[model samples]
Target: MIAFEPTEDQRLMQDAVAEFAKATLLPRTRELEHARGVSEDIRRTAHEMGLGLVSVPEAAGGQGQGLVTTVLIEEELGAADAAAAFGLAGPGAFGRAVIELGGPERAAELLAGFAEEGGWDRFGAVAWSEPAPCRTHEGFATKAERTDEGYRITGKKAFVGNAALADRFVVFAQVEPERGWGGIGAFVVRRDNAGIRVGERHKTLGLDAASFGEVVLEGAVVRDADRLLGDGGEEGFTRAALRFFVKHALVVAARAVGLSRFAFELAREHCDTRVAFGKPIGHFQAVAFTLADRAMDVETSRWLVWKAAAAWDAGQSERDALLASARAAAHAFEATMRTADDCVQLFGGSGFIRDLVAEKLMRDAKQLMLAAPTAEQLDQLASAIELGQKLDPALVLPTPDTQAIFT
Candidate 1:
């Protein structure tokens, strides 16, 4: 039987995160936007709440929560501040990739740091997007060459989240240029590496508080032990990448739903109090209908997000999970953007100002829309799956570049 209600533990977790969002994230949203970064104190508080370790298994010193729980937390956080939610959840992607593909010994060694007193003081990032115009279809331009010691990676990754602040980066590179994504592999590159360069920050449309930039690797040497799927070759890497992508898509969908809900609430409140023709604007059919439509959109998107998250937790097939997540993300992105626009309309001139959050919600919605596996791409993927076409293993899976939004 299908269940829409959250478990007791899940409800408790949701409430806790909701309270934190109201108490911390909401009040700081404007400050962080102005600063263009989340404070270290906020980051530490997030870690202390176990947001960073939500994806890690209990045996690995994490809470062992599933994707559904993580999405629930993300929704609440995103409602308060999208960038802060992204910052808090960003490290989980890297940590999960390590646990899934790096073997138990590697997972133990790397995750141990997360258990330290401060709790993940250093940010984690994945470098996957390339500066090349054909990056989307052609895959990464970065190359990883086999070496006696391990591998030498040389390439530039564009639009990497946390590039300026990440202490560790999970970089993706092709071992054989001719093979494209089939030759891709993932390697852990520390920020302190001699040949690695963190580039200037990129000013984005939204998620302003989260750092986004480029990472350049010029003959950076990586030890064999640092390779996530050492000796498992491209096949192993591709499989792990797909799993990560599906998980990330679901989380992004959740954020969209949250942001849309926030916009809807703002619009609803404005409609209720604002006077028009000697009465509340909400009494007008034109205004009331838009709010009603937005309410429907937000509700629909929320359910879709939950369904995708639930499929993942239920151990559904990768194709099924991916399809669900892709569909949810694409729809949620559209819905949220529309809702944000309607919110702006409801607020009239005030909505356009920075003081009003409606404008910010619209900006944030656009960022989510453009984030990884864009709506158009996701629709195509869904159509391809429906027709039983074989997906390009790498194309369907999330790349370091494509999956950066979830971070």
Candidate 2:
């Protein structure tokens, strides 16, 4: 039989993070948004608590916890402030990319110094999404050419998380144009490189505390050793890359579940207190039913996310995990949006006001959906897996050819 309950250790960590989120994040959410970043004090506190390293391997200078634990903590953070959760300093998507694309051998070398003192100020990013797809090939417009010194990369990546702050980046580029999507390569690009520069930050609708911007690689160069060619066995690099994106999306999905929970709770609390027709609004049938529906939404999304996370930790088949992740992420994205929308509606005009967090949650829910592979993209992935179709990275993964999703 399978177990859905979190282990005692997992519960302890979850509770601790929940406490921090409520005390530190809940109150300063607007402050973080107005500042357009997480505060130094909060970052330091989160870092000290090992929030950034919970799912990383010990060899990578991290806590060696599983994805299950990571989601639990992420949910807590998302419940209080989803934007701040994204803004917290850490390797983040960059770490997940390296582990999957660069192989485990490089994790120790690439992930160093992310967990040490002053690490709160350090960050890493993945430059996956481009401003537009390549018209010539079914891949990124960014090109990386082989050079005697390594490779010369030229391109612009957009919608990158921590773009303005990260010094390290996993920049994906076209390696063999004829091979199309399969020819793509990922390289470790340093911000200080002579040819790389960060573009202006974007004015996003939500998740204001999280920075998203562009990175311009004007003939940037990297050594051959900097390239990440995963040992993907017979299935090759495409499968590995897909795995990376799927897992990354699950993390984002877990956060969506928390956002759903937060919105549902907020709406429920309002219904309990706000009186209408001579009693609490919740006493009415419509209000009570809506709350019940949202309650189910929260629970369903949580279980789906948990099962997907558990599949990864349990080392299930790649197909099984991929399907689970894709479905979970897609469902959570839609559920979060619905829950937030209903929350705002229940607020009866008060939700539109920034004084309450309903409007913010609604905005965040939409932004979070695009923050990863996206519900539409994930649905496609799940269909491909369930139908036993060929797993093409161009089709399943969140590529520029499909959609320029935020990383």
Enumerate clash totals for all models, in the order shown: 3, 0
Predicted candidate 2 versus true structure: per-residue lDDT over 333-381, tens digit per residue: 9999999999999999898999999999999999999999989999999
TM agreement with the true structure for every prediction: 0.92, 0.98
Candidate 1 residue lDDT tens string, 145-165: 999989999988877877887
Give me the candidate number with maximum lDDT: 2
- For model 1, name the residue pairs that clash: 90-407, 128-401, 129-401
Clash pairs (backbone) in predicted model 2: none
User: In model 1, how large is the Cα lDDT of residue 65?
Assistant: 83
lDDT (CA) for every model shown? 0.79, 0.91
